[model samples]
Target: MGSPVGLWVCLWHLSLLLLSWVGSAASGDCKGQRTVLRTFPGFVSDGPGNYSVNGNCEWLIEAPNSNYRVLLRFLFMDTECTYDYLFVYDGDSYSDRLLASLSGSSLPPTLEATSGKVPRTGHG
Candidate 1:
């Protein structure tokens, strides 16, 4: 068996490595990160280019006008539908309305906000 001091040193190093990894994942450069939004006319994505790997990100489109609804357009989309997806909600929260779930190589149709009279604004 390893000596007690050696084992302790290994555990300490492992713990530090884990902490840094968690921090990096939480870093701005990581994918599938979490965020909350209270305003509209915004955009979100899995990262810079075509999603290179499995990742996820939720988007909420909400406007305070109440009369205004969210609009969305999928300019570019090619994902592993069976393993990855992009979910859209009509309101400020996930429980609001499941607008759509986009994945695969197909481009989703243009979407206009269902409620409100404000000019349509979309994000992807």
Candidate 2:
């Protein structure tokens, strides 16, 4: 038996762990790759790992250098156009600015973003 404070602390720790698990399980960034904005040569996929699916993910990547702009090339993409779509935002967040909305089985053309250290988030 533990005191009320002790029980509350245990519950708090459990809740924290559950939150972490949900974040990983739902978004599939178990490796915490999304924890930091990408520099370059980033290979993004749905939750878990490559070919992983059934969930949503947000991939944030920034320019490789301060002087170079970001050119994103999608080598391959096969998704459900209506249900599963990849959205590119010019800025870090998705608000009043959308760079591109891609879906279906075709590869999209290369994309460029500002080089002012502005970040971009890809919601898939």
Candidate 3:
């Protein structure tokens, strides 16, 4: 039988390869040009009452100037209402950034959602 140390080394390498493949798949298709820069979420009061709920949020986009489109997905759900927000940032300077925001609402057990893309043109 092979040495225990040799088996462990082989397993470690295999695990690394699998992780790389999974990471690539999770980022979506963009000719290997997409990445999630940052993400933040918070809990808030469901409505006028004292009740509160949780939701999901994310921020992802293809690297700027990659000549590829950007897709942004966001979902928020709570007892009072559900909300979804999406935005795009494109400009020569930070001051010229663009923002597109969207939101949805519905009761519990019924999900309200929205999604779209921010197309990219060679000219910013």
TM-score of each: 0.52, 0.56, 0.25
Ranking by lDDT: 2, 1, 3
Question: Can you write out model 3's per-residue Cα lDDT over 43-124, one digit (the tens) per residue?
Answer: 1111232221232223232233333223333233222222333223443222434543333332213111111122221110
Runs in model 3 deviating more than 4 A are 1-56, 63-65, 71-84, 91-96, 105-124
Candidates' lDDT values, in order?
0.41, 0.45, 0.25
Model 1: residues >4 Å from true position, as ranges?
1-33, 36-42, 50-54, 115-124
Q: Kindly indicate the candidate among 1 and 2 with the higher lDDT.
A: 2
Candidate 2 vs. true structure, TM-score: 0.56
Best by lDDT: 2
List model 1 lDDT by residue over 19-97, tens digit each.
Answer: 1222112112224444543343334434444444444443333345554444565545656656655665555555655
Q: Which numbered prediction scores highest in TM-score against the true structure?
A: 2
Model 3: how far residue 24 lies from native, Å: 7.5
Error at 116, model 3, angstroms: 15
Against the true structure, candidate 3 reaches a TM-score of 0.25
Instruction: Report the C-alpha lDDT of model 2 over 1-124, residue by residue, as the tens digit.
Output: 4443322110000010122232112233433244344433444444332433454455555544444445666645666667666777655556736767876777766766653232333333
